[model samples]
Target: MHNNEILCRLLAAATLALGAAGAHAQGAAGSWFGGIGVTHIAPDVSSGNLSPPSAPGTQIDVDSDTQPTIFIGRMITDNWSVEVPIGLGFKQKIQGAGAIAGVGQIATVRTLPITVFAQYRFFEPTQRIRPYVMLGLTYTYNHDEQGSATLNAVNPINPPGGTQIDVENRFSLTPGLGVTAMINERWFVDAQYAKSFLKTKTTLNTGQTIEAKIDPNVFRLAVGMRF
Candidate 1:
């Protein structure tokens, strides 16, 4: 199956399992919560050498993308929980910078980020509003990479035509902070801000490689129901 389809199935199963577990738990600690939200992903992208000595010191920048997000959380304690964050999909634009500045868009790629967070909710458990902090790890899968004609004109090997580029899958540490406002007994609104410290390399079909640091900031707003 497609990766996105696989992700959807995995999340669906997790929700059912967590809900079942919550149904049998007498206390609030084991309760299950699930949410859907819109997330904005902004990348602080920087690169090193599109091609050393040839296109020497050519750097690139990745533009931002936004997508829908889904997450499920299990309350481990009155003040702590574990949550998994998943995306519908993301599309980013790669632009030339520094030595290759103003070359416009060089490529485009789609990404899926898989992340899990360990969160600490502050204040009294009975309060209607709570603020939280979380730390997690993420693995980003990149695919559907395509090159633009502008990039082809600059690349030595594919000077006459464009060729695709591939971005390697990578892992990073994610850290975030957010707040939850209780709407009723089992409903709430959540807003969060997170960042991933990620680095990866991209390889061109012509055998050239470039290293990139994509520390992306994420913003999310969601509505959830607790079981």
Candidate 2:
């Protein structure tokens, strides 16, 4: 009789667990959610020049080397959402040689990056964990690279001088993927990765052009509460 009683209790417990899970799932349906996350960007380099005012007989490589970033996202439905993030980033050493004296040397540049994304979740809304993929557009506002450049000239006394050059703003397309795990009715965590694939052209006041390929790969981690 004791063994039968134990079996009955076990079945009852299982039934309760299932009932709770069903209710949780139902509660999640059609609910709106939003989250904030932090991300680390990886450096992406541009190959050859594809834009005009090309630096004659010069080869330059531009790399996006920036700091951590923060992003916000909103779920529009069970499987669809939109995300927009704004952050700041810097460029690594710009190296090249030819036209200008400091043509091949390393210089630094700063940028403001803004992105908008559309995402689609793969799992059911009721589940505690969901995986998703996204694609979107990114815009970058580049500040001038201010550094002294040694001018190419004849005579030591009149040695070519160096001056500062400011670059322009650029835009591009960015895409990525991510996953979100629900911890409870009101809390969740997420991890994501994304990359930008586009080219940008920056013209200097001196009529010199810097062709940059804006390619940034990033990783993000965040914690959030869903209302």
Candidate 3:
């Protein structure tokens, strides 16, 4: 009798738990959601030559940056959504590579990546957890490029006060994966990872140019509410 009583209690608890999970799901379809997140941007660089007037193999490397981000999303269907991420610019460290390897940073460049994503979420609407795949387009605007003392000292092309670089703005395709877990009827936690296939040319005011492939990996974590 005692064994049967315990079995009945366990089943009751499980039923209640499933009921709560179902209540949390409420399906975000046709709803608007917004969240605040923190993002990390790490560059995976394929450095290239700094052209003539520099070393035969004068190349450069880039470093990572992190910032707070805000995102707004709309659920177009039970399993699809669109998201836009907004944030302040990220500052990147431009350092020497290849022939100038081991040399420290030579410049600082600030960039703002504007991206729009179309995501397809998986799983039933009644489930509290969903995993998603996203495809996005991004345009990164590079500006405020300032050269370091190292650049002026080492480059034969350096003239007058100093030599600064200008990195052209470019567009990239971003593909990503993410998951969201509902905590209750109104709140959830989300985590995502994406990669941008980006490349650009940097021109020095002194008439030197270098090409680099800065394929960056982006990671984000956030808590959000659905309305």
Query: What residue pairs clash in candidate 3, if any at all?
Result: none
lDDT of 3 by residue, 1-227 (tens): 23235334433433444444544683568988888878888888998898898988999999888899999999999999999999998999998998988879999999999999999999976778778899999999998999999989879978898988899999999998877777688877777888999999999998999999999988787778888
Which order, best to worst by lDDT? Answer: 3, 1, 2
**Every candidate's lDDT:** 0.79, 0.58, 0.85
Q: Model 1 clash pairs?
A: none
Q: Model 2 clash pairs?
A: 96-103, 96-104, 97-104, 144-166, 144-167, 149-162
Model 3 accuracy (lDDT, Cα): 0.85
lDDT of 1 by residue, 1-227 (tens): 43235334433433443332222212158889998988878887767887643477788899877788889989899888999987767999999898789989999999888999999988766776667899999999999999998788777678345667999999999998877766667776677878899998998878888998999888777778788
lDDT of 1 at 51: 63
Candidate 2 residues 78-97, lDDT tens each? 78888777566655455554
Q: What residue runs in model 3 are displaced by over 4 Å at the alpha carbon? A: 1-23
Error of 2 at 99 (Å): 11
Q: Which ten residues in a row have the lowest lDDT in candidate 3?
A: 1-10
TM-score, candidate number 3: 0.89
Worst 10 residues of 2 by lDDT: 151-160
> Each model's TM-score, in the order given?
0.85, 0.67, 0.89
Indicate the residue-level lDDT of 83 in model 1.
Answer: 95
Q: How many backbone clashes does candidate 1 have?
A: 0
